[model samples]
Target: MKKQQGLSVIAILLVLALVGAGLMLVFKIVPVYTEYGDVKNALTALSAETNVGEQTLRQEFDGKANVSGVTSVKGENLMVVAGAGSNYLRAKYQREVPLFGNVSLLFHFDTQAGQPPAQ
Candidate 1:
């Protein structure tokens, strides 16, 4: 019997299917993470601002989130915690992405920004 030198049709199909699934996942998940990064940077900038109040922070965050297309968490959802000598801004949210049929992927993000200069 002669040995087959290349991949069979079944093997090629299976490999292609896996690659397609992986690419699909990347396409679906990359946007969410990109938005998360935007939100994080916005929060960090807000934290760094001096003399900015909660209301101002919320307004800024809302604008930034809108521009960044971050729908997972809104400015109203941000938690402003006051510590002994500093304050912190926290955002916690989740994103659900539909994959194949009823299958879905869930991503949870929790990010915090502390006062730029903690005294």
Candidate 2:
């Protein structure tokens, strides 16, 4: 008789469990990253505009954030930097996402408009 050519029942169940865990992580983590994108877009847009006051920048970011459904970084968290020839908007924040019981993921986000993204 030929040897078993496919996964055993136990092996299949283990694979399924691993796949389920991966899917759960993706579902939980993707939304947070999406919100980060929204935050970055808001910063980029604000940085492109000509604004003199930090308060104006923050207010503009808040409006964009509200429309974008971004909750990770708020307008109050933004920093206004005056560069040589232009002004930039930056946001630095961290998020703690709870996984299963006591296990959580920590994410650090720092974004500066008019500059390359942080790696």
How accurate locally, in lDDT, is each candidate?
A: 0.84, 0.82
lDDT of 2 at 27: 96
TM-score of each: 0.86, 0.85
Work out how many backbone clashes candidate 2 has. 0
Q: Candidate 1 lDDT, tens digit per residue, 16-113?
A: 99999899989999998998999899888777666667777888899998988888998899987544444578898998988878999999999989
- For candidate 1, give the lDDT of residue 116: 36
Misplaced by over 4 Å in model 2 are 82-85, 115-119
Clashes of 1: 0
Tell me model 1's lDDT, rounded to 2 decimals.
0.84
Against the hidden true structure, what lDDT does model 2 obtain? 0.82
